[model samples]
Target chain A: DAGITQSPRYKITETGRQVTLMCHQTWSHSYMFWYRQDLGHGLRLIYYSAAADITDKGEVPDGYVVSRSKTENFPLTLESATRSQTSVYFCASSESFHSYNEQFFGPGTRLTVL
Target chain B: AQTVTQSQPEMSVQEAETVTLSCTYDTSESDYYLFWYKQPPSRQMILVIRQEAYKQQNATENRFSVNFQKAAKSFSLKISDSQLGDAAMYFCAYRRRVNTNAGKSTFGDGTTLTVKP
Candidate 1:
């Protein structure tokens, strides 16, 4: 409850379905990030929000969408789930957009697209 | 664009022994930060250590330390007195200090480290 948390720790959905993974943080950090961990590719960032109402794309952002309407919440949405989109999604938060600040990670959401 | 590479796919060390995991990166930027993250079976990403490119001295935390070579663009993690709890997938990451690249970290493929008791 004191740190970052992710909802639907595990999920299973069919192709072309829409699903949203929720991430909440209690730290009120200014920067929040969404990343997907896949085999051979490691963890690739999907989107990052510098602050509430401000978000930017990362390395792999084609199929994913993210929004940060509130500083404590950053949710990632998969509008049309595909098998390639199945991976462990992680949410991270930091105090600011500085490189030295350590990121606090959530428990991660494991989603499977069938 | 910056890239991080963890050459070792897997590594093992006997309990109480020491082991080092190699990491290399390709970057033209002079100022950046490097980090090592540990992911255990529970799937939580824990920051093990961090090093700044401007600092000549390596960073050390308890049993974990990093050998940062700015010129070679190499950052390796060395674990001393390895324990069973140390078994996990270790990732090497890089982030540029510039504002445009801040908050975005490039992670390596990761090396799965096993500790033998």
Candidate 2:
């Protein structure tokens, strides 16, 4: 109940379609992040938030939009999904803005774009 | 931009033997942090160890220990007396110590370690 949770654990979508992945955390962490894992490339950050209403781009933030309307929620929206966007998405949270602190990760959402 | 690299993509070790996973990172900032995370077949992310760039001492967590050479920008994970349960994908991550709005850790490609009986 206290850990991070991601909705729609498995999803299949069509190209050009809009899809949103939801992430929720009960820990009240100050920072939240979204990452995508690809074969050979590993997990790459898509977007992250320092706090509610504060978000920044990561290494691969293109084609993705994220909003943190509240501290407990950070949702990712793919305005126009592409086949290349097919990957496992993960959500993580940390107690503070410091990088050294341990981060709690959600179970991840596997999205397939056909 | 900070880049983390895990040189070995896969490795195998006999049960009860020791194994080491190598990791290297490039960062312009002098202050930063390093970490190792383990993901088993279940895909659950688990923390193994962490090291601060400013700390001279290496970080150890039970059977797991990290050889953090800040000057060389190398952070390797050593698993002593490894068990079959240790088989998993291990990742090396890096982040700046200066602090920022992004609470993300730059991750390496990852190494899949196999513990053979």
Candidate 3:
């Protein structure tokens, strides 16, 4: 309740369906990020927000969408789920964009697209 | 673009022993940061250690330490007095120091480390 949290710890959905994964943080950190972990690819960043209403794409951003309407919340949406989207999604928050600051991660959400 | 590589796919160390995991990166930027993250069975990503490219001395934390080689672009993690709890997937990551690209990190494929009791 005090740190970053991810909703729907596990999910399974059919391809072409719309799915949304929620991430919330209580620390009020200015920077929030979304990353997907895949075998042999490690954790690839999908999207990141420097502040509310400010988001940018990362290494792998295709088929994924993210929004930061509020500082404490950053949700990732799959416009049309594909089997290739099956992976563990992680949310991270940091106080600033400084390299010295460490990112705090949430309990990842494992989503399976069938 | 920067890339991080963890050469070892798997590694094992007897309890109370020491082990090192290797990592390499390709980058042209002069200022950046390196980090090692641990992900246990629970799937939580925990920061183990971090090193700054400008610093010549390696960073150490309790039983965990990093051998940072700026010229070679190598950052390796060493675990001493290993325990069962140390078993996890370790990731090496690199991040640019520039504010515009600071939050995005490039992570290696990760090495799964097993501790034998």
Candidate 4:
């Protein structure tokens, strides 16, 4: 597909285990972001990258790690998953930070940590 | 720090009727942007409409419109002639206008809209 997509639309993991969620976009957007959607919390950014090899933390980045070695790919990893970390993960990309640039989001990855 | 709040957790409206979702934000910056996003069961975040802070007039997209009150820091969405397809989670978001802080969006908890026939 020409749009953004998330791998493993659904995932299940145990506490303390390591898991990674993948995101890919065909738009070659300069900015890529990872966000988690939980009940009562619409969506909070976890990490974002401006370009290849550059990433920054977001509101809920305490236990998450991200890498952007390519403009088309941005993957988020959980070093030690916890039940608190279980939520729907979404990946988004925008052409630029300009006000006219609207973000395009992937379908989302629902992760369950038991 | 900027924060967006959607007071209504869930709401329902009969088809062909109208419904409004309220959103309030706290920010010190003068120039910024407010947006409404819709997410259906498919979980795809779609931009419903957006309003620029500098503009005095509100923003509208077809059946969707926003009531942006900059002084009051309020941005509410009004949907007219609601349809069954309108049932979804609607989120209000804010973003700074500056390039340095523009890529990140601060989102509200979201308002779930249920449409009945």
What are the iRMS values of all candidates? 1.2, 1.6, 1.1, 1.2
Worst 10 residues of 1 chain A by lDDT: A37-46
Tell me the lDDT of candidate 1.
0.94
Error of 4 at B14 (Å): 1.2
Show how many residue pairs clash in every candidate, following the order shown: 0, 0, 0, 0
Model 4 misplaced stretches (Cα beyond 4 Å): none
**Candidate 3 per-residue lDDT over residues B1-117, each given as its tens digit:** 899999999999999999999999999999999999999999999999999899999999999999888889899999999999999999999999999876799999999999999
Clashing pairs in 4: none
Q: Where in model 1 is the C-alpha error above 4 Å?
A: none
- Residue A5 lDDT (model 2): 96
> Candidate 3's error at B25, in angstroms?
0.5
- When 2 and 4 are scored with DockQ, the better candidate is 4
Task: Write the residue-wise lDDT of candidate 4 on A1-105 in tens digits.
Answer: 799999999999999999999999999899999999986678999998888998988888999999988899999999999999989999999998685579999
Give the TM-score (vs. native) of candidate 4.
0.98
Cα-based TM-score, every candidate: 0.98, 0.96, 0.98, 0.98
How many Å off is the CA of B10 in candidate 4?
A: 1.3
| CA error at residue B6 for candidate 2, angstroms | 1.0
Q: What is the DockQ of the complex in model 2? A: 0.67
